[model samples]
Target: MVAPPIVTLLASLVHPAAGVLVGLGIGVAGGVALLVQTGTQPPLAPARSAASPARERLPLGLVGIVAVFATIGGVFGSFNVAAIATAEASGAGAASGLLLSAYSIGSVLTGVVVGAARLPGGPRSRFLVAGAVFGVVVPVLVLAGSLPVLIALAFVAGLATSPLLITGSSLVESIAPRRRLTEALAWPPTGVALGATAGSTLSGLAVEALGPQSGFLVTAGSAALGAVLTLATVLFLRGRAASADAGSTR
Candidate 1:
């Protein structure tokens, strides 16, 4: 009795660390790629104001990119907490390994599609909306009491997790200044840490009170929140014309 609740809470708090670490590794890789692309020393310096307008935009652009990333990390970390709490309550805690695998699967699927298709802003918005829809769907599956359904949901959930994140990372790369790209990448990892901690702690308590199914419901709600945030980010980015311009004056 006590074990389930304790485990549920502990899982919620701890599991996000896994994702945060994964995201940080990805950010570092991206920074390396950018470094290689530009043939510049990888440093966390701000761009000089006297540089070209595009160049000057780099530092602020990085900040914008970091903003998008923090949103992604926070959303996904919330999902992880929910997944862990629900699994613990359902006596499926041992099976929770599927969550990470599922997330990876989702990320790969999204990466392939995004990289392959050169979509405009409108299409990209649709893509993010679709991800949000998946976010809503996956937790609902977990709330249902079918083992097979939950397994399938795991894969779908994983897929959703990756694409949403990749889009955010891509945005950061596109807009952040060359000088601050490395540091901008660092922001996502820190955000992931904070997100993971909050999501886990909350989900643990929620599961303790309401049960596993309700815990999943809460998870679904958080996913919806993430979806809404992604949509808002898309709209904000679109309205601003470009990330560089939006963050330039700051």
Candidate 2:
């Protein structure tokens, strides 16, 4: 979400290829920082042997989580280049960063709020929040006559998207078994990346074949699909809870 705009800004001052290089450099730097930070964390308690995978069935709830996250990531990633291209079509290509910057600002604010105040409806509900808002906002980009409107809605998009990323990651900590936690935590991001790759391809082609305005349709459609996937997640969790309760009663 944040990387695209920063790169675009660099692109305008330098060249398009430079923008891509800078974004990759920032990503590598961030990865290194993340590794350093994780390495510094205190050691965890011993893993629970009960979490051994031989006897356990993969929880459908976790599968559902991966599906939703991947769906959301694809839609969100589609906008990475599509949004800038749309802005370019509007003759705001030079200032495309403004749209993405506002989106990041919104995400930052939401991060603070989510940290301070517990958002109602829990982690799974974030899918609904993100899907609905992004679905609506992306389609409306076609109607935006100026960059300011795009920026405003882009900020709103940030607010919508941050929760899906934050809450989905948070849920992994609670739902994954102690022994499998590291591997379990990985699925969401892996799904997200794969979906994003797909989205980038889909959106890029849409823009080239159709027009900049048509590119937003990719976002709108994908986001709507994400919202629908949330129902699967909800139902899976409910069924899991019921099964657990039934087992307990025995």
Candidate 3:
């Protein structure tokens, strides 16, 4: 079935007042839910002092990295055409959509591959790195601008997203206290939303002030920062594990 035009319908139905009231009501309800969930049993166990946690506090780190990636995804996903809009490229918007879709398709395929394959150092560590590298590298390749290269980069960048997301979610499930699991789970999505909103809002100013070339550079920097953050998270997790092991041996 075709979806209703919710935005248009809502505009018609809520002459601003209804819209404000409806949004406020939803916000209030969501706040109540958050309070309820926070006070209840969380999903994680009481963190063991010397025992290895199935998931460490990787989510806290991954959330930042993935949110930046998600921002890039959203920028390339929706604003590519507008960002590149010039006499030479009138169809940039359409191209952006196609490119973002290709990127997403790559991510889905990669998730299947990573999920099924048993690689050394394991999926979380290996794939998280892979995802971060892809996040950094893709923007560089896109700036270089050969169609085949862009396509490949897009796919690789897209493929990396799922692993980052999966690992981030797993970390949330494994590390968060049972009472606060829902809040933990919400972080990545919240980051994604914030990132995308910021990217979309600022990208226009970036392109106007710095040009399209520099816009990619800014995005690349964001992606690189994300990678560094991810690596830092891994290091933090490893350090925690090592300390736990040493304590146990002592």
Worst 10 residues of 3 by lDDT: 1-10
TM-score between model 1 and native = 0.62
State the lDDT of candidate 1 residue by residue for 132-154, as single tens digits: 76557645644556645676776
Residue-level error in angstroms, candidate 2, position 114: 1.2
Superposed model 3: Cα runs more than 4 Å off: 1-93, 116-119, 122-124, 146-149
For each candidate, give its TM-score against the true structure. Answer: 0.62, 0.82, 0.61
Candidates' RMSD to native: 7.9, 3.3, 7.9
| Candidates in descending lDDT order | 2, 1, 3
TM-score of 3: 0.61
Shift of residue 138 alpha carbon in model 2, Å = 4.9
lDDT of 2 at 67: 78
Q: How big is the positional error of residue 18 in model 3, measured in Å on the Cα after superposition?
A: 22
Per-residue error for 20 in candidate 1, Å, reads 14
Superposed Cα deviation of residue 209, candidate 3 (Å) = 1.7
